[model samples]
Target chain A: MSKKRIIAVSMVLAMLLTGCGSTAATANGTEEAKVEQVGQDTTSAAEEKSSDGEVITLTWLNHYAEAGKQAWVQSVKEQFEAKYDNVVLNIETVDADSHKTILQTKLASDDAPTIFDLSSNADLQVYNEAGYLADLSDFECLANVDAGLLKEGQVDGKQVGIPIELSGYGIFYNVDMFNEYGLEEPTTLSELKNVCETLKANGITPFATPFAEAWAFSCYPRVLYDAVCWNNDGAFWEKLADRSLKFADCEDFKKQMQTVWDFHEYWGEDAFGTSWDSAQQIMANGEAAMIAHGSWAVDGITSYNPDINLGVFPMPVSEDPSECRMIKEPGQQLVLFNYQDERIMEAARNLYNLIYSQDCMRVYAEEAHQMPSVPGDYNILPALAEIVNYPAELSFSEAGLKRNDPEHEDVLFETMMNAYTGSTFDVNELVDALDTAFDNIKK
Target chain B: MRKIRISSLLYILLMLLAICIFIMPVALAVLTSFKSKPELAKSILSLPATWNLDNYKGAVERSDFLNSLKNTVAVVAPSVVIIVLCSSMSGYTVARHSRDSRALRLLDKVYLASLMIPFQILMIPVYKIYKSLHLLNTLHGMIFMLVGTSIAYSSFLYVGFVKGIPHEIEESAYMDGCSEFRCFWLITFPLLKAISATVAALHTMWLWNDFNIAVILLQKENVRTITIKQFYFFGKYTADYGMAFAAAILSMIPVVACFMFMQKYIVNGIVVGAVKS
Candidate 1:
């Protein structure tokens, strides 16, 4: 009787599973088929003007899923659809890690996103070498952007991407602390050191340099590079890769690095166990006067103390105020794959025109809470409002791409931290270690 | 008798300590979930300054929590049942016939060998094949890949458990004029319940939290599972730890409930299998 009951139960369960599986499978198949038909429709849609009264869907795969960005994208989508009734701009946002994973296949396939950016500036070389990036040098929509600003996203002197927004890395200082100490924002290295001395005298740490985390500390090298080698393009990186240059031999690179000795003296001693969050805590809670971080640090600081009066400035690397520059990189680049269908490519270009339009640029700037990338009268970050204007004469220094020696980046960062955390700092030793590590990488 | 009681009490206390050690992070997550951003920054370990539903509201609106939940159930439920049923049949046949049939023996060896190869090695190749089959961006396709990738290891589990079971039970059923299908399902399968429950529970948890293959295959918004949705959730919203934790707890409730319920059967199965062997 027990055996009969077990058989009966098993049969019923099997029958139920089969029924559920078929219903779900059929529904999934219908979804898949419908999506395929849309792909075919987009391919067959009208080219350029969308003159045949068919909708051309431009699929854009991006990784900027921030709430502000989503709002801005939606605004652009509505404006774009209103302007061009025949063209539909479809956008999908994935995370950076997964975007990079999907792009491994998507970039090479013919069915790639109509508009998307490469994961890194270094990838411009790889994707360009593969002929996967569309050269938009002749794009009339991109004509308003300064040639120099657009050059950061280029490879082999062909414009491959338009810089969307800027991520400025600099000194995030406590405004209230500076005011209480009667310290004006420092614009040169000597003044910065004096400010550090005043903060130290007042029993506050000056810099939360985060030596415990190599990636957080890694941005310090860019600070030195920004001071000495602003706008060298990818020349410095390619030289380092091809045995043409060594860090010790690069004079400008070595010139600004001596300031790190002061950094080590001020903050490196107790920073061995500090993380980015702890460093932010130190700044927000008034334990530290400033942090060697970027514009993105504001959110973390505000989360700690909503009323924390904080400001950003270009970390002065030399005595001359005129030469001071923010260490800068693109927050994201707007790009299209060359492998996509031509009609879809044209539709994406039209959408780009609207995205870079003055109205849309203002929206993008306000959402990013940063200065406008292109030349425009727009709202700027209040923290950055004092010392800078749109397209300030003081420029930005883009990091040299480590094309072949990618892992050597961590080696470089770890070496910097390792040098700074020592009892005494030596600039030459740090630079020598960097050169040795770079040389050791198999080209 | 007093010494014995004392030792037993100590053992139970140690087990309770072990449970607390494991549960600390979860307790912290629940605490942090109720916090606002300021409260989170003030202290991650302490209670929220003011309990509110705002973080949960933001997580729901942003993550499409319910739709992803529906999709997760759609993918995991059918996949687990199919894996259990098919692997059990294959395991039983191979366990019974491998010595007599060279093909069956080779098939068993191949399944065992395939377990050693990592998914990273197969990821790109599977992706390319899926693309050619127009299986990209489809939940059913993802389901197919999940079932196919999981079968080899699942079958290997069943094969070991079946070999340990007495064959005379099935042999007697066949001799009593019962069909081979009835003999296995009615007589042998009921006896194999402990191991079957273990496999079902293990695969259910795994398929719930699967990210890699799901990330690659389920690229469309309408088809995304909860894990993939959370990947995008934490991408740029990580600054607001209160909201991040809220989103985490919301997504975790179902899977944690699942694990808690399945955990008892899993432990019992393991112990019963050990005793029988």
Candidate 2:
């Protein structure tokens, strides 16, 4: 009756009506969208599915959230659903940063995904200890997978994770920029430093180290560690793990750090504030000529600039070029969960067998631009071809680090971040800190 | 008079600077949304060579803007309504009768204690409880959790505001033969409108942008809110900034409009509530 009351009532009415979504046959007229969210479960499809038959939802929590990977995953889901009409793959792809928290909560609860991805060896061990891993040691499809790659996912000598694909880290350089300056891919430590100096003199930034990102510490900095020790057949790691080696004793390790400290000068203002995304954009825009990251970065880089020409070479961390090798490791692994329901577990198995097949993995290798863990003839990214095909003596597999306790790699990443991030860089302090950290890890 | 004018001028200048500081990021997001990735990489502060609507188009397609908007509205609207209705009554009873009522006194203490516990602490337990109830990934559970977590703070605000009101307003209605419920609704409720609007507006913004509760509770793709939908734009190593900013700019519109509409009530409610009974 009153003006104030009338207005309040109408606002509530409007909110309620809007909240109760009125379905309209809305469509963007006649043009396909370039960037679209894929794998949306339509209500109509769900209804149609239930109307005719029983279709179970197999939940999967994936870590790949980028557009290029999502598109490939969307196709994979569709193909799987079409092939197996009784099961709908309820795939949820969260960004890698927050995926862990969501996943830990879900995995602990009754709502855990039947299948999930773990980014690190430490994660595999933790989840395996929690009794979440569904003893995939007997999984039949794994017969075709490389034993060495499969070992990367093994925890306590028990096969838990099914290695899906692998990605490698290298010194990514802009080929066009390198060609413009007449600089070849540097092989030795001296040549790499020389390239940085020349690029700086020519008013081009040589490296866009995304030191602001905690994960970036694992990319280029770890490559430095691997370069010094990778050639010794991981004897340095074995001794270090056994507390027999001090980081200070390795002269090459100090040389690598000194090289890093030199390269640190090439990073311009806000260097520590540079994010992985900003670093890639800077490299793509030709603001920076080089970034040391991995095979996974190619899609993101090329998406930003379609015409950008890129190439990867081994990070020259040692004076002896032969000792400097690119670091390629198994990426995320898909581990089956221990489920009680027979129907759900069967569906999970069907999905697993389908995905691990060469036909499905080809999409991952070709589109996602990473090497499949399974033995398959797939074309590697042209930019990464040199590093992937680098002469055996000049390249190292991350599976070599598998000799050391899997958890040591995580400690090394944190220690390197601490050492590199300090205002004062000291080789002795860095090595001592690393030695102490390894000692602290539970044997 | 001259001194006062000079002081006023200084205050105005200070206010403008503060406004700019607050507005700059939003302005940057808007500008970035209109630029291509190359242009954005060139300079985050520079104007675009072309006012490209393509990013907005891409974001609309990529974020499922319409469905997420519908879901956000569904969760936020009902949660705000419940929070306002429940908090107002609890606040009124606690303010008016807590001295004589033992149950209300205990509840007030419980709510006051609950406010100190952060949502991050309750995230796992709440998730587990919801899973048992088969409420995970449902709008029903999402609304319930949002209201449950928010009611404590909203009631505290109402309790503060309700205590400031004179008890004479309700007494007069009671003297005229009005029942307690009718008297409170027709008489005291109108007087409490300012705080209610404030509560509704604050909760709308908070509930709309709520990530912690919604993220854990609403994991399904179709049930995702705009905040969750926008999260997929970022990857571990890279992000599509142009499209993400576009989604941010678009999503901010409803929130901004709601805040502006209730701006008067929010300021008045806070100022009134800050005064002692």
Candidate that would win on TM-score: 2
- Scanning candidate 1 chain A in windows of ten residues, the lowest lDDT window is A23-32
What is candidate 2's lDDT per residue for A74-102, written digit by digit as tens? 87799889998788887887767667777
C-alpha lDDT values of all predictions: 0.72, 0.77
Return the clash pairs for model 1, or none: none
lDDT of 1 by residue, B93-137 (tens): 988899999889999998999999877656655765787788988
lDDT of 1 by residue, A83-151 (tens): 987877777778766676566545323355677775356666655655556888877777766444576
TM-scores of all candidate predictions against the true structure:
0.86, 0.88
DockQ of each: 0.19, 0.24
> Interface RMSD (C-alpha) of each candidate?
6.5, 8.0
Candidate 2 Cα misplacement greater than 4 A, ranges: A1-54, A230-242, A340-343, A375-380, A403-424, A436-443, B1-12
Clashing pairs in 2: none
All-Cα superposition RMSD per candidate: 8.9, 10.4
